[model samples]
Target: MKVFTALEAKNRFGKVIDAAQREPVTVTRQGRPSVVIVSAEEYERRQSRAWRNLLAVMEQTGRYAAEQGLTEEALDQLLADES
Candidate 1:
């Protein structure tokens, strides 16, 4: 990853975008990490993996809830609390 200050990244926006195509670029604000710019392909890959992981977790939770005989309203409340 390449680190760039927020001002530097703004001044050299094109370079930051170009670098992101090759690998992730870290943009910082006030010396703190603010965001990471990644290529479209990498972003899509990460999004897909996250979706899959969420589904797996939901499946496991559903199994556990089933074993506990959780009612629909209780499950809905549990999910609402998580949100």
Candidate 2:
């Protein structure tokens, strides 16, 4: 990742786009990271992988709940308690 201040990124927007094509570019505001610029392909790939991981986790949790005889009401009550 390449770090660039907000002003630098704005002034060299074209270079930022070019850099993003090759890898992610980190844009910072007041020394704090604000955003990352990545190629569309990379972004989509990461999003897809994240969604798949979330689905797998949900499936595993569902199986565990089934095995433990956890009902919707019990789960709801647990969530309500947490809140």
Candidate 3:
């Protein structure tokens, strides 16, 4: 990842976007990291993977709850709460 100050990123927005296509870029303000710039495709790919992980965890938890004799209604409630 490449770090850039907010002003520099603003001044060279096109270059920053171009760099983000290959790798994420960190944008900072007052020397503190604030935001990340990344390609849209990369961002969506990450989001999809995250959702898959979350679903796997949820499935495991639901199985455990079922083994513990939780009712269907209660399991549905638990899943809803997690969401």
Candidate 4:
């Protein structure tokens, strides 16, 4: 990863973006790390993995709920109430 001060990143936005295409770029503010810039492909891959993990957790929870004789409608209502 390449580290760049916020001002430098702002001034050289194109270069930072180009670097992100190859690997992640870290942006710092006030000598502290602030943000990371990643390529779209990397972002999509991470998002897909997150969704897969979330689905696995949901499947496990659903199995447990089913074994407890919980109904789908009741689960939907409970989730809606929380929202």
Q: Please list all clashing residue pairs in model 1, or write none if there are none.
A: none
For each candidate in the order shown, give its overall lDDT on alpha carbons: 0.96, 0.96, 0.95, 0.97
The 10-residue segment with the lowest total lDDT in model 1? 71-80
* Per-residue error (Å), model 2, residue 82: 11
Per-model C-alpha RMSD: 4.3, 2.9, 4.2, 3.0
Off by over 4 Å in 3: 73-83
Q: Return the lDDT, model 1, position 55.
A: 100
Clashing pairs in 2: none
lDDT of residue 67 for candidate 3: 91
* Local lDDT at 79 for model 4: 93
- Which is the better candidate, 2 or 3, if ranked by lDDT? 2
Query: Which candidate's TM-score is highest?
Result: 3
What is the Å distance of residue 37 in model 2 from its true position? 1.2
lDDT for 12 in candidate 1 is 100
> Can you write out model 2's per-residue Cα lDDT over 1-83, one digit (the tens) per residue?
89999999999999999999999999999999999999999999999999999999999999999899999999999999998
Candidate 2: residue 20 Cα off by (Å): 0.7
Residues 3-52, candidate 4: write the lDDT tens digits: 99999999999999999999999999999999999999999999999999
Candidate 2 structure lDDT: 0.96
The residue-by-residue lDDT of candidate 1 on 5-81, one tens digit each, is: 99999999999999999999999999999999999999999999999999999999989978999989987898999
Which 10 consecutive positions of candidate 2 have the poorest summed lDDT? 66-75
